[model samples]
Target: MEKTYLRAVEVDQWQTRQDITVTIPDSFDREVMASLPSLPDEPEKAVEWSGMLEMIGNASGVLWQKDAEVESLKTQIEIQKKAMLDECQGLQAELKEARDETHRANAAAALATNRAIKAEAWLQQVKEALASGFAPHLGRAPVERPSVLLAR
Candidate 1:
């Protein structure tokens, strides 16, 4: 009977390589070994190794799905952040416009107040001139008027 050596390769967490050996039984089914991608010489050990490989594949698939979900969430968060920033900028512009309008209103009110003050001063001058009997001399040809002399 020829002895066959079965090689098992295992990698650590750090990906350091290690080799394991198991003896093959002579009575092992050749048909089952042919179906497996990598043949383990021992029948019982082959079943265990195949199960472990299946588990590793399943775990890797789950990790990949989780990574994809994380990426999608990150993209959504970025989009929301950009929208919020745009809203803030719009509000800032509106605030600036409101401030400018308020300033313009204040300037208009000040001008109105100044014009009212000048009008009041002119009215006072007119009142003084009329009280002093100087209204007839304003912008017209002089007319002779009879004056009554009063004794004080």
Candidate 2:
């Protein structure tokens, strides 16, 4: 049997691990490798490493919770955006209906105006024929009696 000495040293800026150099009999090397110590012997380094691993776990948990919240908020935002788009489409349809109604009303108004103009023209022609004492030169048939005389 041979004696082995292992030392723990800090690695990088934030980590500590064992640094060991050993010469052992071939038969004992396999046993030594199988039963190597997992933790540093120094109490302060062990405590620090344990606390750091715990902090990392806590931070990872917080990050996962925050990610879940972010996803929930994104889903809510998508729902709101869809609702707003539906509302906008509805409003657009309503506006188009109103515009179509206005166009129909305008067309009806134009027709009525044209009819009124034609009525006025016809009335003026009739008045002129009466004032001219039933002129035969007009396109109408000659009247044998005046309209007023016939009315009486």
Candidate 3:
């Protein structure tokens, strides 16, 4: 059994250096060693052909999956953001509607109070006219204010 030293050859205009150390296992001649390309200073560059190809393929697949997952997460985040924005707008609209309803209710209450005051003033005037007919001296002077009834 003869020791077969592994070697590497730099190909013309290629980034990858070819493994030129594929020994004819049965050949034990020293002249065969001379024909092989020179080995590099770094021994890690030499690898079993099948294993290195598998590693490269697996790495590419993982990178592709990572990119796809990132895109999916980004889309989900955008959808969630849009939903939150829509909810905010809906809440704002509801708040505005509530404010408008409160304003209308306040205006209606003020109008009702004004009408009540006018009605009370008219009723007092009519009462005074009726009393003047019975006493004959009720309407001879300045009329008493309706606000005096509220004070009593």
The candidate scoring highest on TM-score is 3
Worst 10 residues of 3 by lDDT: 143-152
| Model 3: lDDT to the true structure | 0.65
How well is each residue in 7-124 modelled by candidate 3, as lDDT tens digits? 4444776576455544333343444545656577865664454444446556755765676689799999999999999999999999999999999999999999888877877787
Off by over 4 Å in 1: 1-47, 129-152
Error of 2 at 71 (Å): 1.6
For 1-152, candidate 2 gives per-residue lDDT tens digits of 55443333446777744455444444664555456565556535433333454466567557656766897999999999999999999999999999999999999999998887777767766775785765656666655533332110
User: TM-score of the candidate numbered 2?
Assistant: 0.53
Question: Against the true structure, what is every candidate's RMSD?
Answer: 13.6, 14.5, 11.9
What shift in Å separates residue 4 of candidate 1 from its native position after superposition? 31
Better of 2 and 3 by TM-score: 3
Q: For candidate 2, give the lDDT.
A: 0.65
**What's the lDDT for all of these models?**
0.64, 0.65, 0.65
Give Cα distance to truth, residue 67, candidate 1, Å: 1.2
